[model samples]
Target chain A: MRGLEKLVTGRLEGVEHGSGVGMDALTQYRNSVKERLDSADVLVAKLVHENTVLSQTVETRTQEVENVRHQLKTLQNRVAELEGREARQEEEIEIVKDLFEHLCGVRVHKSYEDDTGLWFDASQGSRNGIMDYKLGFVKNESSAGTEVVYVPLLKQRSSDELRALQKQLPGYMFDTLSFPLKSLYQFYSKMARSLSKKIE
Target chain B: MRGLEKLVTGRLEGVEHGSGVGMDALTQYRNSVKERLDSADVLVAKLVHENTVLSQTVETRTQEVENVRHQLKTLQNRVAELEGREARQEEEIEIVKDLFEHLCGVRVHKSYEDDTGLWFDASQGSRNGIMDYKLGFVKNESSAGTEVVYVPLLKQRSSDELRALQKQLPGYMFDTLSFPLKSLYQFYSKMARSLSKKIE
Candidate 1:
């Protein structure tokens, strides 16, 4: 009976030892699982944070691009307005040029010296008196106002004759006049008429 | 002895059942972890795909914006070019107009009737012989060539006198001459000299 009791006690102790080892294995497994879960949670959180930053960056960049587009639209409108004004100005210039050409019956030429004036040819009722005419504005040192200079070809006429003629024509102030075209024409017409009457 | 055997056997069976239950619980936990890992993998793949597509969309939109910027630059250049041309043309027109006014001795006015011409007053040496001159281009139905019309005030002159005058002035073609100003001036000058000689 003593030998049988010893064997049974030894078997019970062995079972108890086996239960202790099983509990330790379960504890180790639970620790490993907890660690894996913690790591996964950290990864998900990092990914979510990165995604939020990227989305915000996209929104900011989109707003900046929209602002650039608006600026481009405004510039386009300004360009169109300038082009329209330029076209109208060009048309106005053409009309004025055509009118001048038709009325004067002459080809207009820019002066060789500068772009400030124009030069042309005129005749006094006959080829015997062809004149090269220059029409321009001049500023005198003593004068406050600009004067219109109308120089007709006076190769045959003396300075005395020119002075007398200027005196006879009320508007001429020594080849310069306030009124340009009208005064020049009147001076020539009066001279012609006076010369004609002298012969008559 | 029988009672002791029953106690040991029952305890052994209880331990086996507890181990079986622990194993079942561990398996259930493992399966749940595996399901979570699979769902996370699917979510990661979806996010990666969306990121790639978004990146490609950003590239395309950037290219579109760049294209618009290039177009805007080109338009701006064109506008500047047009404005420059318009300014130069305006200056040219102004010079031409000033030249005509100075040479012609008349006020240039646009005819209200048509865009074909301008009107001005002219004189034949005396106020008694003032003339309304029409200087214009004419295209006759019967003629293939365009003619320049220079109609002078012929109020007192007879048709017979005009025909004789036209014959005497080699350059006159019934007041329609290829060279308007020179021919008209020559004809008038010859008449004035002839009339002066007659009076003398």
Candidate 2:
């Protein structure tokens, strides 16, 4: 009976030890699973933060691009307007040159120099046919190798005709040759300004 | 004693009920935390996907802008080149016209409706030996305003000298003679072609 009692006690102790070991294993598994869940939560939170920052950065960049595009379009329009103005100016210059040619009995030569002026070649035609025409500089001096535009002016009476007129008119024939050249420039400027205004 | 034992049993049951309520509250809290974690994960994933798409779109838009800028620059350069070519062509045309005038002893007149080729008069000698060269175009087609352009083909000769030459060379002499007509046109065409080639 004694021996049987001793054996029973030893078996009970073994069972208790096995139960404790099983409980320890269960607690360790639970702790490992909880740690994995917490790590996953942290990773998702970091990703979310990073995504928010990237979205804001993209928004800022897009706005900058739009602003740049707007500026570029404005610049293009300005350049086009300037080119149109330049073309109009060139055409106006041609018309003015033509008008000068038609009005004066001298040839108008456009200088490529820093100054725009009129140059005359008085030594032309036959020896007996010496052309007498007055030429005045409009803007500047003449330069070598400059392209000169020659335009023959209107038909004016000869010196002999003028002398005949003077004899007939007598005292009324005073030399009104000396006129202020500045007035001519002012006249053309006024005409051009009026035309421009009309056209606008 | 039986009543006292019954009272103690009721108190123990109350303690067990309180423990059960606590366990239920813990379960509910754990479930709420799990739901929140799942929602956060979904939101993070969606944001990440959206950010990736936005980045790609921005890159594509930037490339398009660069391409447009390059094309605009190319177009501006082409326009400048065309303007330069036009200026050169105008210059070349003027040169050709001048050459023709020098060779033909004629001047081009841009009249309103009478754009026909005519003659220029070398008006010789006024009363004071002052003469002029006059240019006129055919206005009426009745030769009303037309004059004669005397070409200096030979050395200077007087009227008596020309009469003597006609008497000596009677076979070659003709009235209202117009020689070098075809050769003059051919020369003009050749010169024009050369000038055009230079511009090209």
TM-score of chain B of each: 0.48, 0.43
Residue range B12-126, candidate 2, lDDT tens digits? 3443355342434324433433443354446556766777887776677677567666756765675676567557545533442332233222233332223554443332211
User: What's the lDDT for candidate 1?
Assistant: 0.48
Q: Tell me the lDDT of model 2 at B143.
A: 40
Question: Which pairs, if any, clash in model 2?
Answer: none
True contacts kept of each: 0.22, 0.08
Q: What TM-score would you give candidate 2 relative to the actual structure?
A: 0.35
User: For model 1, which pairs clash?
Assistant: A125-B185, A181-B105
Chain A accuracy as TM-score for every candidate: 0.48, 0.46
What's the TM-score, to 2 decimals, of chain B in model 2?
A: 0.43
Can you write out model 2's per-residue Cα lDDT over A81-108, one digit (the tens) per residue? 6567557545544533332232221223
Candidate DockQ values, in order, are 0.13, 0.05
What is candidate 1's lDDT per residue for A45-132, written digit by digit as tens?
5666666666666666677678767878887787778778777666655555444444333333334334543333433322122233
Candidate 1 residue runs with Cα over 4 Å from true position: A1-95, A111-136, A147-200, B1-28, B59-67, B70-74, B77-95, B105-200
Q: How does residue B128 of candidate 1 score in lDDT?
A: 20
What candidate 2 gets wrong by more than 4 Å, as runs, is A1-25, A105-200, B1-41, B64-200
